[model samples]
Target: METQLRKGAHAVFNIQFHIIFVTKYRKSVINEAILSKLREVFSRVCEKRKCELVEFNGEDDHVHLLVDAHPDNNISQLISFLKSASSRIIRKEFEIYLKQFYWKKEDPSFWTDAYCIVSTGGAPLEVVKEYIKAQQKPKM
Candidate 1:
């Protein structure tokens, strides 16, 4: 699966990113307010970076973002831009829950520094989007 996923990614300059990252320590703070604000911040950041925000939705502990980032932009820079910009806004603007978890007591930050990135442009956009849109936590 990894090989099939990674194939053509090296040779082809075209690539899109479907990324998933979690809150620091997987804390559940991505409530309605934070999610809404994050939507706005991510939109602005993507516009600034010339990336496309396909979709972004989160539960409490984690987030999933489908990004159409150009090949010139790698996963790290994109995630960095999103995390930094969103975290700052979220930390200051909506601190009800974020305060105790990340903003106060030097908790390091809200989001964990780890992320998973995959190229979706290798497949048809529709197929890629379906996979992402269908993504959900494993059934109990």
Candidate 2:
């Protein structure tokens, strides 16, 4: 993992976050098309927020984001933005899929309210990279 530290007005920092968000009820609705769109959506969101999206990957029900943001950026706010923006776009674009799995009177929730966010600065980037990569495998 090549992590270049970012410099701001007064502070030079390298802050990265490992963020995970699951579909509502942990439904396995995500496919390759959705994953591709998600990567694009997340990249756009991060760019708008002036953050770097280091890496992104997902399974059927959830997605993982590795973001390198400035220290001044509010992590929770970023998470909210990611979830909201992606949810709206995804639900609209993939209405057919949503209808089958997320049928409801109102707009079905695209993502669960709860999320997992962790700071990656506590460990080496390589270690974190391996950990994230391992998420794809089944436990023995």
Candidate 3:
């Protein structure tokens, strides 16, 4: 993926993250329809946060996202928003499909509390270290 730097008033940054969100109880309820809804919701959430949803895909039980975010964005809060909004919308839109997994009596949670997020993009750590080491030092 190409790394594009974004300019803010005081900072220029290129930050990207690979995040994964799993379904509560690892239920295999997600299908093409739900995935489509998820992509729509996630894209909107990212846009609202001044970020971009670079890539999005998922299996029956989990979803993967490659997000390009601004430096000032709080990733934790963004994830929370994504989960909450998507859960509420999905529960309402596909209540029939999800009923088997989440009974009427249950609270009807979509995603698990735990998630995996890793910083991505830019050069490898060792490559960056080598480049820094190769820089010429100025004479004092």
Which candidate gets the maximum TM-score versus the true structure? 3
* Residue runs of model 3 more than 4 Å from their true location after superposition: 104-106, 136-139
What tens digits encode model 1's per-residue C-alpha lDDT throughout 2-80?
Answer: 3222223454444557878788888887888778888888889987876778898889888788876655566677789
Which runs of model 2 end up more than 4 angstroms from their true locations? 1-3, 122-140
**Pairwise TM-score winner, candidates 2 and 3:** 3
Q: Which candidate has the top score in lDDT? A: 3
Show where candidate 1 strays beyond 4 Å.
Answer: 1-14, 122-140
TM per prediction: 0.71, 0.82, 0.91
Which has the higher lDDT value, candidate number 1 or candidate number 3?
Answer: 3
Per-model tally of clashing residue pairs: 1, 0, 0
Task: Write one digit per residue (lDDT tens) for candidate 3, span 52-113.
Answer: 99999999999999999988888899889889999999999999888889885567688898
lDDT of each: 0.75, 0.90, 0.92
